[model samples]
Target: MKSVLLLSVLSAAAVSAQPKLTLKVHTGKGQTGYDVNSTMIAGEKDMLVIDPQFTLSEAHKLAAEILESKKNLALIYVTHPHPDHLFGLAVLHQAFPMAKIVALPATVNAAKTGWPARQKFWFPTYGNNIPGPDPVLPEELTEPYLTFEGERFPVTGPLQGADGPGNSFVSIPSLKAVVTGDIVFDHVYFGVPKDAARENWEKTIDQIAALHPAIVVPGHQGPGATDDMSAVTFMKRYIEDWDKNAAASHSAAEMKAKVLAQYPNLGMEYTLNDRVAAYFPPAAKGN
Candidate 1:
């Protein structure tokens, strides 16, 4: 009996001493107007993926990375309902049939409503570059933590951020990392919806900064932009600058010129004009 007790203790100790998980961040192409991000969280026996990506081609590439990991995909978490974030779910479903996809109830509703409109809008620009506007809506997360095999890993939020309402982020306590869906952008143009709530988004940025994560994985950015907290800083600065410029500028052209001057290297210039128009419509007939 003593020998058996000793062996049990030894086994438990071995399990406790195992190394913690390390996360991997994958960035899709920037030219798509939505530089989507996908994060993989690995454990000893399985892995979890966050926010697959935009196009079918991108999802295929993301799946290939997971397959190469040789770890069972335990679950997939869709952070938000934006078409770029949720539209590639069909591809992931084909790749990881066994993995359960989870999201907040709000995200599901938003995805359903936005899917059709986005399909029409993107078709002309993306052509056949994207897969089904048909997204695999996620099963609502019934519990506070995600379970892999029998072990539990805690995930926080339906946390709203930069992309507005229904945006969420995933925090892996073990990895000291947070996968921030559109709450943050690194040197990328933030989508300014026609009815953007600037104050709410700024508040969300504060909430994210409060989390004090050692590493931040933004929803849209290039590869070099991941694994750093600078995205948070840049996003805050961008919003502040935008608000300032929008208030002072007379037209979309003026706002665009001022913003581009401030952030010369920021990509998605085409969208910048749209954002300006959203906030400050063209001055009517040279008033």
Candidate 2:
């Protein structure tokens, strides 16, 4: 009886020493919001969601998944200020009122300042699929890292990414995983606006690669994309291709064609359109 009791105690101790956190990703459909990835990092009793969704309906679906998990929703961390990453805060807040939604100060400010313009621009296209006028914005996160079940998940950056600047990503050391906001994308066209600094963005990708994370949850990915270093490799190659093609082409259409020919199967062609337009806007009518 004593030997059995000793073995039972040893089993419990081993279980207690194991890592308590696990991660699950909920990716949007390819046609919906460019297959944006929203990850749920769950501890033994509580969980944290990173980057909600673009549409209210999709957010509802994400909320349902969280509900099914049966873990307390402790926090929601917005990775960047883009509407696609943050527009669903209202739905999530309504569903999990107790969860504290937070982001870096820069992200919070950009979201608040860009909300009106973003709503005006996307409302017509999304039509009632998005949140109404008064959406819930995340509070400014003052801490350097997030804590879940006594483990530290460090928040790094405000660095330049495909979406421009003020982009932050979260790292789980125990998991050797990084929840990259727009810093990385898997088999998806990048959103490179007019003001984007390609050099800086490349540097950011290098920084992430240096970490050698096993799991990389990008801001966007194609269907069946794996969470691995392949995304980082793709991002670097895509940026190099963009630079080479952009320099060779005389018009936006030419640039688009070149890029498309190179990455014919990549998702989010709309992003490529935006990228070319930003780099090669049509010449003035008089010219």
Candidate 3:
């Protein structure tokens, strides 16, 4: 009996000594840039950041949070190439120069090639709020997963997302949590651009649901969005509604009206207008 008790105590001590992973989320509220989420996965002595912010001010705030955590910033993972998700790389890189910033190869390529146009399009409105002329891109990640303190955070995708292709998510299997890029949106209008494939996006969401993640951190969220399966459910339902409404409506205006009626309280109505307009442009003059 004494031997058994000694072994049990030893096992408890071993479990207690193991470093546990915790998550800290920094969400950019609506006025700042659509409430993009930046998640920090912290271990005992080190942490990994997923998806930096859109504006410089927000990024600086995120950096301050990281500093206060008292954990070494070891790795930074960008889930996609979108400006809102990765434009803050410069701020983070400056703050933690020794940390490695990485993303899937396709994402790296897209950011490299798309930076010039993205800058031009957003600069006029965002002005100096965004990153400067010299963009800081992430390195290509060759490995299938990210590692910190002996644990693996699996990287999935280049999967079909609302923003089109070259999107990815990082999954923490032990925690049953996923840091989804624009693949998921909480209480915001989905970015269904002209090139976006609704069917493919639905399938991708289905795949994510299959993982049974307890915590679902969306790339964009609203004021009081929670990190859970609700985002996944919301995206799936929203897409279904979009498909149904789009098919019945004759014009983008009609479609937008129908969707709004369904989700009147949803934020980012501009995104809905922009996407529908791309789908149904005005008739050529004098035709």
Q: Estimate each model's TM-score.
A: 0.83, 0.88, 0.86
Query: For model 1, how many clashes?
Result: 1
Q: List the RMSD of every prediction in angstroms.
A: 6.8, 5.8, 4.8
Ranking by TM-score: 2, 3, 1
Residue pairs that clash (backbone atoms under 3 angstroms), model 2: none
Per-residue lDDT tens digits for candidate 1, residues 8-64, read: 999997887655576888788756636778888888778888898888788888889
Put down candidate 2 lDDT per residue, 1-287, tens digits, no spaces: 99999999999978876767899998877556657889999988999999998888888999999999999999999999998899988889998999999999999988988988899899888889888777589988889898788888999879988777888889998888999998888888886533447678877878877888999999999854799888877776777788799899998889999988998888776667777887886677995
* Global lDDT scores for all candidate models: 0.76, 0.86, 0.85
lDDT of 3 by residue, 1-287 (tens): 99999999999978876438998799876656557889999998998999889888899999999999999999999999999898888899999999999999999999999898998888897888887767799999999899888988889898987777778888998778998898888888876633347677777888888899999998888755788989877776876788788889999889989988998877666567887776577887987
RMSD of 1: 6.8
Among these predictions, the greatest lDDT belongs to 2
Q: At residue 284, give the lDDT of candidate 2.
A: 73
Candidate 1: give the clashing pairs: 162-183
Candidate 2 local accuracy as lDDT? Answer: 0.86
lDDT of 3: 0.85
